[model samples]
Target: MSEHKPVPGHRADYRHFHAIQTRWMDNDVYGHVNNVVYYSWFDTAVNHYLVASGVLDIERSPVIGLVIETRCNYFASVAFPDQVDVGVRVAHVGRSSVRYEIGIFKEGEDSAAAQGHFVHVYVDRESRRPVDIPEAMRMALAAIAVG
Candidate 1:
């Protein structure tokens, strides 16, 4: 059997997008945004969406989503002084976990410069045990779900 390889996704593949401005410090000695910075963008994009949708209260929410896994693939390089847009979509939403796919695109570009995913497991903030996703959070996630 042949394994399926990941490919860059287009803007239409995602349901939501968040804009991020790259800082000069994001660039590495090679003059391109460092690979590690892309991961930060993924976290920022997803959290920003959750907060903007009114489903997450970072300071007081009883449940929190903690990243359990993350992976990324880069097709092109991006640098500082560029505004990038990150597209987000939910690939899977389990009772206590969600698989979120993300894409980073240069301003006005149609295809992603990088694509990645991260799994967030919802857990009780105090107990640190897995918990069912909140209804409001589920609803917000539904808005960005994909097959």
Candidate 2:
């Protein structure tokens, strides 16, 4: 881990939040939520936000954001069936890519159970080439940037 550690009361510059319940299968042999599942949570958080914000029309949008990179830091163990709250923020917004950072916490708890980040590069639906972020999307992402 880095010198920096996530602590209680830390709020991400997230415009919205969503609650997710951990499923029993989310755990691996050791009894803690597996590392892989954390990444999925990151995806679910960002996608759900975009979908609800009307920035993404998963089925018919002429534009799409593709995952270009990802990273995570697990500070503590979270078990299955636990109520988890996710906080998200836009760390960086580029011409065609946006970097989203997320923190996972146990419901009713303060500090994050884990933290992670992922970058999504928006591109043309058909060409799959990078494209400038639409104004609407930019506005949506800005709402999530940490001050």
Highest lDDT model number: 1
The TM-scores of all predictions, comma-separated, are 0.97, 0.91
TM-score of model number 2: 0.91
Looking at model 2, which ten-residue stretch has the lowest summed lDDT?
6-15
lDDT by residue for model 2 over 62-98, one digit each (tens)?
9999998998887778997898888888889999999
Off by over 4 Å in 2: 1-9, 12-14
Where in model 1 is the C-alpha error above 4 Å? Answer: none
Clashes of 2: 0
**What is the C-alpha lDDT profile of model 1 across 106-129, one tens digit per residue?**
999999999999999999999999
- Per-residue lDDT, model 1, residue 10, is 97
